[model samples]
Target: MNIWVTSWVAADDGVRLWTATTGAPGASWPVVLVHGGPGLWDYLGPVAQLLDGNRVVHRFDQRGCGRSDPSDDQRVARAVADLECLRRHFGHERWAVIGHSFGATLALAYAWTHPERVASLVPLGSTGLGDWRTPARAEHARRASAQQRARLAELSGRERRSAEEEREFRTLAWFTDHADRERAWAWAAQDAAAPHAINWTANRRLAREVDSWPEETVRARCRRITAPATVVHGAGDPRPAATAAALAAALPHGRFVPIPDAGHHPWREQPSVLRALLLRAIRRA
Candidate 1:
């Protein structure tokens, strides 16, 4: 079932969130999914299979992301507050959270402040929690993607891509399943058709505004969290395993699960493994 999650933020600005509920309204177990990009959609189509027992699984797009209205009001702490409001409004005393990429970033922020609210966290395709040199890596990726766009006709229209779009497309394209050369070409073609301008803007802003977060901010909160924590990462992800390792080390009850062949978007590339890992996390959650 799809539930409409609405809330107000810093200003009197109201935001409407799209939420997908797996089965019942109040299940014994609940997983609140936080999507990546702060400007990206939940992309919950593939991961829907994990809600087998018809438990309550929720996915929501942050303000200015997905179907939500657009806004440049950027702040990490504010996003955390928004999440807390949503959790309380949804009536979940404590929830297991699964954050993907930027969502994982929010997970760190939320978990840090409200450990009692989140029972556990399953961060997938985490962007930067530990030691991610995101600026340098993203800058390099931007240049590489620009080069790719120039050489390949499939990337014709992407030559004028924003720096963030270049980085997102180039990196995310590498994780897609093309099946063959033809499919790869087609995929590239599709990517060039519509560049992600919004995410690019948000990413650039976020990179500039927030570079790194200290564990102390979130660590003290983690210690209080009795819920088991597991991190699911794509083995093929370009972000690097060291980042995840560092993040896991910071947390007292953190376990890392690396899925083979999956890139940045583990759930998209390795659905079976993603499902299994999520199910396992659910059991543990």
Candidate 2:
């Protein structure tokens, strides 16, 4: 499908966001996809195909990521502001938000702050609610091979790293199953390796802010979100499934669903299942 690409100043700070619209342009239900990696570019191009026929899908690179303009301010609040700016630019009063990984955390923040602007919320492979690093580390240790573990340990002990090294560490830390790991590497090679494809500086800064975020505050915000919410998690993901369940239960209108055997990138590992869940969420929304 042909995606309509455009660039707009999606923030008051003059950061231009590269955005694409796919699916039925006239669809009443407009859904915005927040890609994983607070820094991961808008690589949800393939995933757009699944929702394009029925719903209008919007995807954009967050500030300093992908095709978006570079900026020193990588705060989570800035990211939320960018989303609001996008909504206003699209003239949508309210829309459904589907976020993956760290993007899910952003989506939740936006929903909590502007519940009146969200029709529904779908958080996929979300983290940031608690001390996710502990469980993630445990899972990595359990799943990584001897070589992978050694490499991870070496990277973890480093006080600093180059962009490529950071990407490599993330690939190992995020994906457990061999196929998923391979796919992640391929994705990084194709998309993230390009010049200005990823803003590592911004990623590092924003990630620290996300990690420092208080779980109690996030849970408190989730409880106040009035919009319907669904937490979709891959069973094979490093983050514990209990976290997703608790997040869903915390929301006033929330449900949790886990996809068996799927890893972090469910779109690659289990496209059909993930697509089905997205459709269900949209229908209910």
Candidate 3:
């Protein structure tokens, strides 16, 4: 199959955007894969696997991540709006929405706001799009934060941190590429060496800008989205299963599938299964 890869910075939310496209040009039915971080890098590997050489896809580093410049917490809404610019930039009237983790929240929020432009929705390892401040999600946040500090100290030759500072460091550690400790730790070092403000600002951005889902009250309002929707979760995900189930059930045409032995990062844990399921979703769309 023919394929193309290109990077360009487009204007988004008053910031210059760094975006990349892979696969053949003019893929009639495009799937836009959103990476899970309110501040995470948009990953391309799993999406590449899921595409399986048969279809083309779009993957990019989201704002404040990778090659893109960082902005304030106010950039969240504007980041969501960037989806429209993405679709229109490629001239797709409607596109398939695939979001993982934090991206899943953005995907649901986007579908909720612009149902007319989404032909399909797939949210994996999702945080329920409801008021996302429940105890369970908070725990997931805490767990991810803990891993960050341990990895950070391991990377830099720094002395161990006090328990309290360890807790504080983890809060700012967003979703990191952890396929390998060497690679993951390199990412940790980048954060460690940066002037305290850049990293701390991201944490401040998370606290100041993120919003919770009105899960209980908000689902009733949007019934027009009849898209082929699939919500997949890791059976052993630290995040709550009930919330994932509730989210899938709430969608007018949602299908819920849970992967056994998988954790929050199911794509890495069960790539074969995830790839198969995602391919099926795309074809169905």
Candidate 4:
């Protein structure tokens, strides 16, 4: 069975970040899971458990998110620096980095800035480089039913939402993130109810920074990264896997993997496949 231990790590700016470590008691290979949502708290707990206690897994709430102390600094650079601080606090010279969605983008940025400090990078369901949201939005609309779409629009048009209304809105908003239409609502609802409310302020700030990255400069940086990166995305995700494939191609040592019949969160739909791929990647790294 996997054992979990929680602790606190201070970022360079002195924000107290909540962190946890788990897995086989003496597991060797160290891996850190970075959750998506520039503003969301750590939601990779399931992924860590899916690792099957084979390696030490680390997870943390980013600054101003979840259990971490709130801070005014929401810069992308600061987030990367906070990750480095977490690594140093754990005494890992190099470690495997696994990130999902926006977290994937952040992981890429981290690897680009600190190539030598990263052993391997696994980006799961990332938005990828360039403009991916347009296609993604269209896909999401197509996947959502008319009633779901109407309800979502109604909730979004609200000037202010009560707690229940907000949850409903979020659930509907995320309903298209799964390929399994029957299960998508449940999965999205679970996500909406997860601890640590979405930090919209931090999301806006960090998203702006992410959007500012010039494509050419980003590709040039990718070419210089030493660690291997595996860009894995769901075949049914709203975000086009082709964009992720292009991202992989731009990297010096990057490969792309597309999971069948899965959407944004592949683990929820294809746990075994994801687990096998992750185990192999971590062991090889």
Error (Å) of candidate 3 at residue 110 is 1.4
Model 3 lDDT tens row, 161-268: 554454345433423423232344344444344332222445346435545324454476336566778899877666776778888888898888888876666666
For candidate 1, write residues 1-285 as lDDT tens digits. Answer: 444333333323565555555655544467778877655666664565455345677666676665556767667876787788777766788888788877887887788678778777787777545556664365335534565544433543564756655654554544233223234444444444443344556666765555644546555555655557788887766676767866676677888888877666565556677777887786785
lDDT of 2 by residue, 57-152 (tens): 899988888788888888888899999999999888889999988889899989998999999899988863546678977776777689988997
Clashes in candidate 4: how many?
A: 0
Better of 2 and 4 by lDDT: 4
Clashing pairs in 1: none
Ranking by lDDT: 4, 2, 3, 1
- Each prediction's total of clashing residue pairs, residues at least 3 apart in sequence or on different chains, is 0, 1, 6, 0
Q: What's the ranking of the predictions by TM-score, best on top?
A: 4, 2, 1, 3
Tell me the TM-score of model 3: 0.73
Question: Best lDDT goes to which candidate?
Answer: 4
Error of 3 at 46 (Å): 2.4
RMSD per model, one decimal: 5.1, 2.8, 5.9, 1.4
lDDT of each: 0.64, 0.80, 0.65, 0.88
* TM-score, one value per model: 0.75, 0.87, 0.73, 0.96
**Model 1: how far residue 135 lies from native, Å:** 11
Candidate that scores best on TM-score = 4
lDDT of 4 by residue, 1-285 (tens): 365789889887789999989885355468999998989999888899887466788999999999999998998889899999999999988999999999998899899989999999898999887779899999999988899899999998988888898889989999898999999999999888875677889999999988988999899988878887888889989999889998989988888989999889888999899988887777656
**Predicted structure 1: lDDT:** 0.64
